[model samples]
Target: MTVDPRAALDRLIASLEAHYNAVAGRQSEDDPAVDDAYDILADAFEVYDEALGTAHGEALPFYLAEEDDDEDDEDDEWGPEGDDSYGDGADVEDLAGEARSS
Candidate 1:
């Protein structure tokens, strides 16, 4: 069944409000309400994005970062214990300079 994009957008806006309220009223650092609201917000965004794309061939300006299962591979690429592959004191400017030279 196709979802109505307008309704989906309303749901997404409501979810955003709920998430903001959850964060504002959070009781502690590890508040479950905030986490629950965040999950709901993510779901609502996905639903709205999909409905909008399907209905109007349009999409939101931003997207949620998807969780990946290849975390171990990422860790390996960064070296043991998540150490960066870059040498000590390396920065973006240095990388940009090297790229320009090459």
Candidate 2:
């Protein structure tokens, strides 16, 4: 079956938003699922940005820098070893594939 990129992007956004909302207004960190969803959404955004030249704006980089900081904080408590939640060197394509399979 063919997957529409736009539809996939929309799904990613919805999932990410839902995860965010589910954990809003709390002192605890975001769920690991939210982080995973964010990564996937970022990947989807990157693909769109590349194909449509939509990521060249200064805002994108600033947003990414902020996200990097958030991710760094998340990394401090994500796994049993306090390391990467998605394992070392796991690319977006692999996560995308897992999402598609599910």
lDDT of 1 by residue, 1-102 (tens): 799999998999999999999999999999999999999999999999999999999989999977766765634445334555543445557778889999
Off by over 4 Å in 1: 68-102
Q: Could you estimate the TM-score for every candidate? A: 0.69, 0.34
Worst 10 residues of 1 by lDDT: 74-83
Highest lDDT: give the candidate number.
1
Which regions in candidate 2 have their CA more than 4 angstroms from the true location? 1-12, 15-30, 54-63, 66-102
What's model 2's lDDT at 98?
86
lDDT of 2 by residue, 1-102 (tens): 344556655765776676566557334575675566667667666554443343233223423434444444534434435543554555557768889999
Q: List the residue pairs that clash in candidate 1.
A: none
Candidate that would win on TM-score: 1
For each candidate, C-alpha RMSD in Å?
4.2, 15.8
